[model samples]
Target: MSPIFMTLLLIVTLGVFAYTANRRWRLLMVGAADKRSDRVGDRVRATIEYAFAQKRMRRYPLAGIAHQVIFLGFLVLAIRSLILFSRGYVEDSSLILFAPHTVIGDVYSLLKDVFVVLVMLGTLVFFYYRLVVKLARMTLSTEGAIILGIIFVMMVADVVYDGAWINLRARAAGAEVTFSGWEPVGSVLALLFQDAGDGVLRCLAHVGFWTHTSLVLVFLNLLPRSKHFHVITAVPNVFLQNLTPRGRIAPIEDIEGKVEREETLGIKRIDQFSWKSILDFYTCTECGRCSDHCPATNTGKKLSPKHLTIDLRNFLYQHETALINPSRDRKGADAENAEYAKDLVDGVIDPEVLWACTSCRACETECPVFITYVDKIVDMRRYLVQERGEFPNELQTAFRSLETSMNPWGFSQDERGQWADGLNVPLISEKPDAEILFWVGCAPSFDERAKITTRATAQLLQRAGVEFAILGPEEQCTGDFARRAGNEFLFQTLAEANCGVLNGYNVKKIITTCPHCFNTLAHEYPDFGGNFEVIHHTEFLARLVREGKLVPKNRVERTIAFHDSCYLGRYNDVYDAPRDVLRAIPGVKLVEPEQTRDRGLCCGAGGAQMFKEEEPGDERVNHMRTEQLLATKPDAIASACPFCIRMLSDGLGDKERTDVEPLDVADVLLRSVEENVPAEQTAGA
Candidate 1:
């Protein structure tokens, strides 16, 4: 390649790359203010682990190895790209080259040859996935194939370039000499060209060199324009990941003021997302791991989280000029705004798609790049529910019931303690000095199917000799469903009300039968100025058993398969406590459904799915999860959440597995405990 042409190519390619990259930076600037740099130490560690080490990618073995090879190859080949560029400027870029005879350079040459082959091998694996295996979890695109093809060619060109150079150097010395040992892969290839004329070998050298060098620039400029942009953004995106508790939803700040100002309640436009979210969109690898695990997607719903992010990202990129250029929409409102806004609610994202999410966090958990989907979906829902009043009609009833009765069932709050009427459960109003306040959630209080679990929990607490009282009429819904459904206003009202009641009673500890209530009180309530030591009934029972406060001496003798509720297991990390409680019971053997713990499927009741009809799907999420559990062939299924129990029990009836009962952990414990109470004590005169 000529020096003048090479130099011009370098200048032009760098100029194009810089211009396109700067355009992305300004587009990111259009997003809402977000602070991600606070925890610098954790950020760096995460970047090195998830980005440098490719931690999450390892979940899929074949793809993991292939990706790691390509990632490491890029890091090593980056130096080679730089060295080639420098050669275009200087006659002998000896400092940059690993040309023969120098000790360090010779070692580098051998290593480069080995990596060239390794990288090409890695490319073949991905090519197999793209062209042959065609994994459904991955997006198939011509652009992806083109990028992989270019990378494959680059690796081959590097080795071929060295092979051609080896032949040229040997012939220049006027000897039929064997190739040097330092060029392992290249030396092997050079032998084939030993009989070739000098002119042919020289032509091969120019072709290999120009092909390798020119393609580097072409690939560089193409990166920001494709999903392959993750090559540059994934590391930074990992570093900027949200560090909040996994179970907590970031609260809406200054809700009253935002309402008064008539500002966008949620994400009314693409620009309303935080810059970190924009990075999330850019960092998606087009790997559908999120949607693969997503209950909504698995059950044939219209919500594919990967496609959602890509759609929003493409929309933002397409309207970059109006968003980044202040002169176009300076006042944040212009007649041209219609072209810019595009109504994020129903225009960019469908209403059915927004409502379809179970908020199981399966999408978030499976995302190798840490791209979040729940927050984005909820944000869109917030806009539709609060600003536009255009959510699914069923949600309107749930919201109305929440506002009036403080429960979705619209039952009398006074009857909350009726489930434990025979168990002597005291109302918090009557026994405010009790050790722990038992928050009998709406489901357990109002839903007849859930009251059995509620009664069992109260009885177990009593058997443990743990002084506890029910909030009864004073207790309200924890707002977990409302908030997740995108009605932030209703959620906030309920949160503030619950917080006020708890604070007024000077409550310091609470035990909940419902994971939804436990998650909200322990994680979400603190944001509303209500902080307490909250425990799920399973955790409470496990602690009591550990302390010898309760003893399970009777042998129920049932092979039990444990169902992990997404909220209890994935959201709150309470997986072990429930299992431990089940394990401690004598003659109780615990079996696991294939998808348990972090990978547990949603029970289909999360994200306010409990309050409305499921969006169109081939199979109910609960039914799918139930089938997986029943495959274990347990005599009974034990769960720690009311929602899980409800869903699984319903599934049992549907599948005619009524012989396989779904029992709450509390129910199992109550049945297992011996006759510890004296007759007079039980009478409680």
Candidate 2:
């Protein structure tokens, strides 16, 4: 064959291979669109700014810079290789800028050489981190390490070929290429190549060039088939994130009727997941960021959100052929199918891992790629409860209570008003025309510690002159526990009943001290067509202070650490209002824990974990949070959610350290007001 024909044939063969590989990758990635809505413009911008420009990576400055350099090097090297391929074999002198003399070509060669060295060093550092240093709780599986080695080898070979080719060409032209300033390595290699025949050097160049190109193409083809698919999916996931209310789960519009349908309520199989959920599986970088922040994982629980996603992905991949081609039967087919059936008791996911999650959203918050781990977990819980009739044994009683009496504790519905027995609080049923209804949640009315918070809130409301009436015996549990525990059916029943009661009355607004109650009433109730303006006591009190309805008369001089409740803080984004209330109290200096707001650790009370026993783990979630709070060394620890108050209080009690007191936000405000109430005229008696 003529040299010209050989060059054309090589170009055509490589081009076809590249196109075919890329097309397959696109086909695999196309399935990621179902869960997430399209925001193409936003995706493009985020991809450029974040994925390509390394915005999020920059948060870890040293590693970020190293990655950015390597990324840029890959881009530059790719362009240089294309230029070399076009010129070397095709006799395309027009593409060879360094043929005779071009300062720009020299500059290009110099910079390319510099970047190749930088890229090599960067890759080495990354390898160490992935396999040795192991930052972000990262570990390299055997396959991962092998892939890394292949990529490293490909890069080194490419750089070596470029240097050798440049040197050979320079010597052929009898041009004494300066070695001191630029292309030092290439200049040395060129001297060695002078002795080798032209044909021999050309053959070596072709071998090196083809090897690099082939490896790069193979890497591209393997990407979507491997964990490295995150490279393409992560950017889009981050950009198209659900920027809506975190506490507000997508409610079932016709909850009762839908359950009667044959359609699945939540994910029962891999294909049952929304495309976004599938994308989440594909987009995970395996960096273990979620596991690093997981309270359950840190506590030695079997539940690692990271591992949960990983396991699901592996299961899906293993069954992909069976799933796509139903006729194809293989060994263990029935067992594998049963394992992915979404019913927790029989599913691959352990009951412990499912229940262990506190729904803290820490995993969601820390996931750099914006994987909504909490949502997926919640969806699985929905499936478990709605279809499979599975849940923790402790939750059985609560579920029964909620079904029978409309409360988790099985308390008499009439007793809901007992929390206000001695107080001047009016019953809303007696005053059906009342403007505001005080929602005294089950915890406050039934649980002793939480009752104090309820009383304090009532007094605060009275002092602020906010007209509010209690539902008394008419109020049932808001069904927050039942819903979170995965009994969506029970939650819907209670919600419909509660909505019916509220619908009968003329309640324009509702307020509650419990974050769980507040969240459910405010966000979830609307799904049941029971829409009312709702506010947490912390928010209401803060507004009262701001409006000058409640004046801060006394200075409570104590340093207090604020424990952000998972439901109030992460679920509802109510972080500021609680802190604002504390800061408004004169002499009450608010000290924040290291992980405050979105990063705040769970107190292990959400997701019905409060009702059930905690799973075995290295550390209790609440203990971990309490220790962090104690690190602040505050006189008191305050929280807005009653559940958080209960858990943190229990944690503090376990430590046997009485110096740090745990108080609800309401307790703090009420105590401040009581302190300012002067010893009323002693002579009056």
Candidate 3:
């Protein structure tokens, strides 16, 4: 074959592949703008700092190093391949001609060979870690494994072909090229090829080269059709990811004050998801990052966020043709279109998996591709709760209670202020013009264990001379639990009622000790015209201490570990404020568990899981969290969320570990101040 002809053919082949791949990519990414607005500069900075730089990955040293090396090696090898192809066949030119075999080309070729070996080894290690060693519970479907294996084979074949070709060409020209200076493994192969007959060596070179090229082409074509589509979708998903409040639910607006009777509130089918969500499904690498971190999954519940995405993707692909041609009848279609409505309900997801999530956002936090698993799960919940009216028995009763009493526990709305009978708490209705409206959440107003936190917070506010008033009996449930449980209608009812009452009072700033209340009031209420500045009690206390309004004199000489609540820490990014409040007390040493900040494990209390019983599992989520906290062996375990406080306290009580007390962040702050500082100083400071 003529060298010039071969060069042109290769160029044409590459151009065809690139064009097809890019066209499909453009189509899939068409409506991404409506789902999420792009901030190019911020994304570029994050990509370089967090993704490519592996800043997040580096926290896990061994795995991080392995991944970083493989990623960087792929880039190096890609450039080397382009250089080799251009010099060997296409545009046959070399810088070495100026100096007649300069050392640079040889050095570049050697380094390329070395990196190829490194990449192959790294991939092999990952394969064993995922499959053989089973260090983690990795998802290895047949399709996924086949795609990975083909990519690995291509890497090996490319290096072998290059080495073999170099040896054959040198032999054909009757030049004695030393193999000793070449890369370790490739040098040995080159030496072996030197003694082979020219005819046999040339044939082997062609076979190796063709095999490498063919595999690359096959991989390219299969990418969009396989789970490996993440290779293309992952980067774009990361770039266009939601940067808004993670704790907040997306608002569903009433179109012209006319609710569409047939319209779905959350995702009922795959098509109903925002295009970004569809991209999220395609971009999941099935790395099990979410599964590993999920409280439900870790505790042996059926909900694996990674598997949820996989199932949704599989269902979409299975019905792709029918979905693309809606007018045409298919095997599963009913003559009267009866089966069309039942397709998603029966096909895409199991009822158990859909209901098992705690809406903890732990999955989304751990996912390297930035998949929004919580949003998708919540959407599915909305379908089941709003449209189908299907839910756990406990949740159904809770919904009824919320409808009647404006609380989930069936307590009388008039008696909601019973917990504050002896305490000096003011009602916002009476003191409607108060500076701060204390939104005492459902649990604290009712639950016995949580009431103490509320009273302490109120007393602390009074001591700080901060004028605050409560909604009293007029306050309704924030409906966070209902919304997270998938009752969008109920959520909207509760949100609108609460927004109306607050608006009537002209409330400007609100404060709450409950993380759930803080999240709902700060994030979701704005959707219903409740635009108050909301602060969690820990954040408020931290600020108070910083301003010298609250002073701590005594040092509690005990190791205290702070548990990051899912809503407060992962959902709202309020990890530091609670810790700051605790650390401000002299002699209080703060110890941290292994999972903190972005990777914090859930207490399994959010998503209305607190109201419903946990599914049968080897370990309870609270027990797992308690064990982690116990490992720190602190004198006390502190938390900001009432649900977390209750769960952890019960877990410890069950374990009969009375020595390690579970205290609300406010209680701990109060105790530390009570012991260290004189009452006069604490009151007047």
lDDT of 3: 0.76
lDDT of 1: 0.85
Worst 10 residues of 2 by lDDT: 676-685
Clashing pairs in 3: 554-676
Model 3: residues with Cα > 4 Å off, grouped in runs: 1-33, 79-114, 141-149, 164-204, 255-260, 327-343, 429-433, 555-559, 586-589, 675-685
Per-residue accuracy of model 3 over 1-685 as CA lDDT, tens digit each: 2366456657776777686566444434432235455577888877776667767667667667777777777677666555445544642344342222457666666666778777777777777676777756566667766765876887777766655766866766887756556455666677777777767766766666666665666766677766677766666777777777888877556722434566665666555666677687778777787888888889888788888888877765554544444466333446235332343544667777777788888887777777887777777787777777788889978999999999999999988888777768888877877999999999989988788788778878987899999988899999999988988778889899999999999999999999899999999999998999999999999999899888877666668878998888887888888999888888888999888777777887888899888876778999999889999988888898889989988888878888887777777677665544432222200
| Best model per TM-score | 1
lDDT of each: 0.85, 0.75, 0.76
List the candidate 2 regions with Cα displacement exceeding 4 Å.
1-35, 38-59, 67-121, 164-208, 252-264, 326-347, 427-437, 500-510, 530-534, 674-685
Better of 1 and 2 by lDDT: 1
Q: Give RMSD to native, each candidate.
A: 3.5, 5.4, 4.8
Q: For residues 1-685, could you state the per-residue lDDT of candidate 1 as single tens digits?
A: 4789897898899999999999999988888998887889998999899889999888889889889988988988888887777766663464644655788788887777778878888999999998999999898999999999999999888777767777877777876657667778888878877787878887887788888999999999999999999999988999999888778888889989998997888888888899889999888988999989999999999999988988998898888887888875745557335576768766888888888899899888888889988888888888888888887778888888889999987777777667787777888889989989998899988777678778777887877788988788888898999999999989999999999999999999998889889888988899999999998989889999999998888786889999888888888888899998889999888999898888988889889988889999899988998899999989988888888888888888888886787888887787778454332221100
Candidate 2 residue-wise lDDT at 293 = 85
In order, how many clashes per candidate? 0, 6, 1
lDDT of 2 by residue, 223-253 (tens): 6667777755776667776745667666555
